[model samples]
Target: MKMKKFLAVISAALLVISTLSACSMSGSVEVETEFKVEEVTEKEGTTTVAGKTFVVKTNDGSGLNLRSGAGTEYDVITTIADGHTVQIINQQGSWANVTYGTYTGWVNMDYLNETTTVAPIVETTAPSGATSSPENPDTQSGGYLYSYAGFNPAEITINDSSWNLTLLNRHYTLPEGYVPQLSEAVRGSGVYLDYRVAPHYQEMYDAALQDGITLTPNSGYRSYQTQKTNFENKINYYVSQGYDRVTATQNASRVVLLPGTSEHNAGFAMDIGWVTEDFENSPAFAWLMENAQDYGFILRYPESEDKQAITEIIYEPWHWRYVGVDAAKEIKASGQVLEEYLGVR
Candidate 1:
């Protein structure tokens, strides 16, 4: 009876060991299977399986513009070069917006491929400060860090609260640090504008002379002290004319500026008072309008009520500011105010 019990115990022990071994094997198999599935899923997610790049394939020329957005009225950021590469940025109906540089604009889907893809990270920052132009910064005097930045006859920088743009002959380029300080300056005084708008303004001066209109740049850059005096004088004049602070300040802002808000502070823009009177209605104005684009200048305040209101200043028809040849030509051809031409408005 004792021998039988011992053999039965041994058999039970063997069965227990076998059951444990089977469970361990099953667990290992499950772990391997799960790992394989996850690996496959991860591979599928990152796989570059379906995309392709399409070159400009047609000889039939068409008018195409790279808009700031998907619509026609949106700003035209840049025109795509014939051989330039564009990564398809998905499609909305018949149009596909592709990104080039810091701008995203629409292109016809027929000209691109649905299967093509480009994973370019688009930068939406404007061309200023940290987001400087693509060309080498050292190559040309492009940055706003020169000895003179943001000085106008008027003292305040003409930019609004946003400081994104300024009012000059055209769109004056104010970089990050050269923004206007308004709240601090009292409104009764003329507003000064400090912005480096020179490179563009100089181009216009040269262009005007080319057209037999000797536009003398009477004032190019002015010191802050000079702007302060100009503002105070305007305020005093207005106060003497029976105008209150608000009215006097507004009127002063038209032709003068509160110290520190003037464009003269930038040392770029200038007041080009003609040798003779009737400069705006003279040949000088006509010549500037005709040939300023070739030399890179634009009459800052266009003679339109709507545009003048946008500029928040009276039309100084003689004042032409330079923006650069490419931008100037675009502005002149468009016949739109600087704000409109720049699409800032």
Candidate 2:
């Protein structure tokens, strides 16, 4: 039975490979083959392959384990330390086979970067302006906003037509039986809640009201198909406007969560700000800063000089994510990014 199961798994893998045989990059055909259980014979001397680099923001204890092949450890090299540069000879799975001098080994490809040097960490001398988390008192937790490592890509949903997982940007309609009630004073108020944050968004609205700030919802749910079209539309619009693919992708990436990688998919994130510059700068924004966590929300992105660590494509003062009141309050008081407050790191 074990042999039969193994063969079946192998067959399924082969079928997937055959289906993807046409996919290639840079004139090189990428063959989809079954995950081979066999070991790769290590070649003596050294060989080089093209790759990219990235700097390490934190120390992941798993030392670069030198493997002769994928998933097989022949040796462990200890000399390589955090913040050291490595030349990647090849990439397999999530591990990058890297070489530095005589040492050749595998490192978690997640931490590797095309840039080796990270900007030095600067301590904020000013008193923290944000709410504090009750979860941990030693330090504020806003560090998650500073590092992409805090992001859990696995939580992101990527479906054929819809993605409803964490960290996904999706299109949805307000669930049946859901209706938003506007306070009489807030009606005709220019401020609108991005519908991407909907019925689940009431918690935030109520919390803001408690602080004497009347916020309104503008946009909410979007379908996956809508996201796909929006993505292509942005690509076309940017290219039409003379923006290259890279810049356009970057610009679009900020506002439009790549179909499968948006937090808006959770139906728990909203963008809020005042009706005018004066309103935006007024006590409403300040109230959000002081009390948003009470409603299970956190400011998604905050301004910082260090841009390399935070992967946020765009900066928005109004965007907030719901993580439940307890977590939100803890995160707010802790002063950590949602990613860190969630312990994604």
- The candidate scoring highest on TM-score is 1
The TM-scores, one per candidate, come to: 0.42, 0.41
- Overall local distance difference test of candidate 1: 0.48
Per-residue C-alpha lDDT of model 2 across residues 1-345, encoded as one tens digit per residue: 999999999998897766675454335565645566776765432333333444433356533433434454432322343455665545666666654322245666666557743322112122234222233322435332111212223332234232212333222222223223222222443332334334335655666777677655432333333344444444333433454544544445544555434444334455454211232475667777777766656766665533213435444555666565776777667766654544442
Candidate number with greatest lDDT: 1
For model 1, residues 133-240, the per-residue Cα lDDT tens digits are 222222334332211212223223434443323554313433324533322111222322233344344445555556566655544444555454454445334444
The lDDT for every candidate, in the order shown, is: 0.48, 0.46
TM-score of 1: 0.42
RMSD of each: 22.7, 23.7
Error of 2 at 261 (Å): 1.9
